[model samples]
Target: MAGGLVAGYVLGKLYLLLANRLRDHTVSIVMQFVATFLVWILGEQLGLSPIITVVVYALTIARVLPLRGEAWLRVQRYAVWDVVILVLNVLAFVLIGLQLRLSLPQLEGPNGRI
Candidate 1:
C-alpha cells in the first residue's frame, strides 16, 4: 500500500511537471483518476483490499498538488461547495477510523485464555 502510494505520488508529480500546458484542475483530476484506477487494478490483481488501494491513491493525489495556497484560494473563491465537501470527507474518514478501532475485538489465546 505504501509502495503504491509513493509510486502514485511520484507519478503524479512527474505528470504535473510534464503536462505544464494543462490547467491545474484538469491535471489534478486526470492524475488522481489514473493513480486511483491503477492502484485499484493492481490491488485486485494482488488479492489486496481495493479500499486501501483507493485510500493510498487519494493520499498520493493529495501530496502531489497544492491542496492549499493559491490554487486552493482560487477554488475557494469560485466554489465554496468544494471546500464543504472536502471538510465532510475529512470528517467521514475520521469517523470511519474511529469506528474501525472501536469495533476491534480483544484477542485471546486458544481455549479462550489470554
Candidate 2:
C-alpha cells in the first residue's frame, strides 16, 4: 500500500511534467487517457494496489495542475469526461440489472425461500 502510494506519486509527477510540456492540444488530451490507463495497469503489474495508485496519481494531477494555473490544460480534461463516465455508468447498471434478472431464480426459490 505504501509502496503503491509512493510509486503513484512519482509516476504522476513525471506524467504531469510530460503533460505540461506538451504544446499540442490533441496529443495532450490523448496523453491524459493513456497516462491513466498505463498508471493503473502498471501499478497492478508491479503488485501494488492499482486503486490506491490511480487515486493518488489522479489527485496529484488534479491538485498540481490548478496550482500551475494552466487554464486550457485543466479545463480540457472535463470537456467530455463527465458525459462519457455517465454514459458508461448507465450502461454498466443496465448490464448489472440484466445479470440480476438472470439470477432471480437462484435468489428466490419456491416463494422467496433462498
Top model number, TM-score? 2
Best-fitting candidate, measured by lDDT? 2
What would the per-residue lDDT of candidate 2 be over residues 33-105, giving only the tens digit for each residue?
Answer: 8999999999999999999999999988888766764678667767757877999999999999999889877
- Candidate 1, residues 15-102, lDDT tens digits: the string is 5564454456655455445655776786677666666656755565456445433666446434654665798899999999998777
Q: Give the TM-score of candidate 2.
A: 0.86
Q: What is the C-alpha RMSD of each candidate to the true structure, in Å?
A: 7.8, 2.0
Q: Please estimate how well model 1 matches the true structure, expressed as its whole-model Cα lDDT.
A: 0.59
What does the lDDT read for residue 11 in candidate 2?
Answer: 91
Could you give me the TM-score of model 1 versus the true structure? 0.39
- The pairs that clash in candidate 2 are none
lDDT of each: 0.59, 0.86
lDDT of 2: 0.86
C-alpha TM-scores of all predictions:
0.39, 0.86
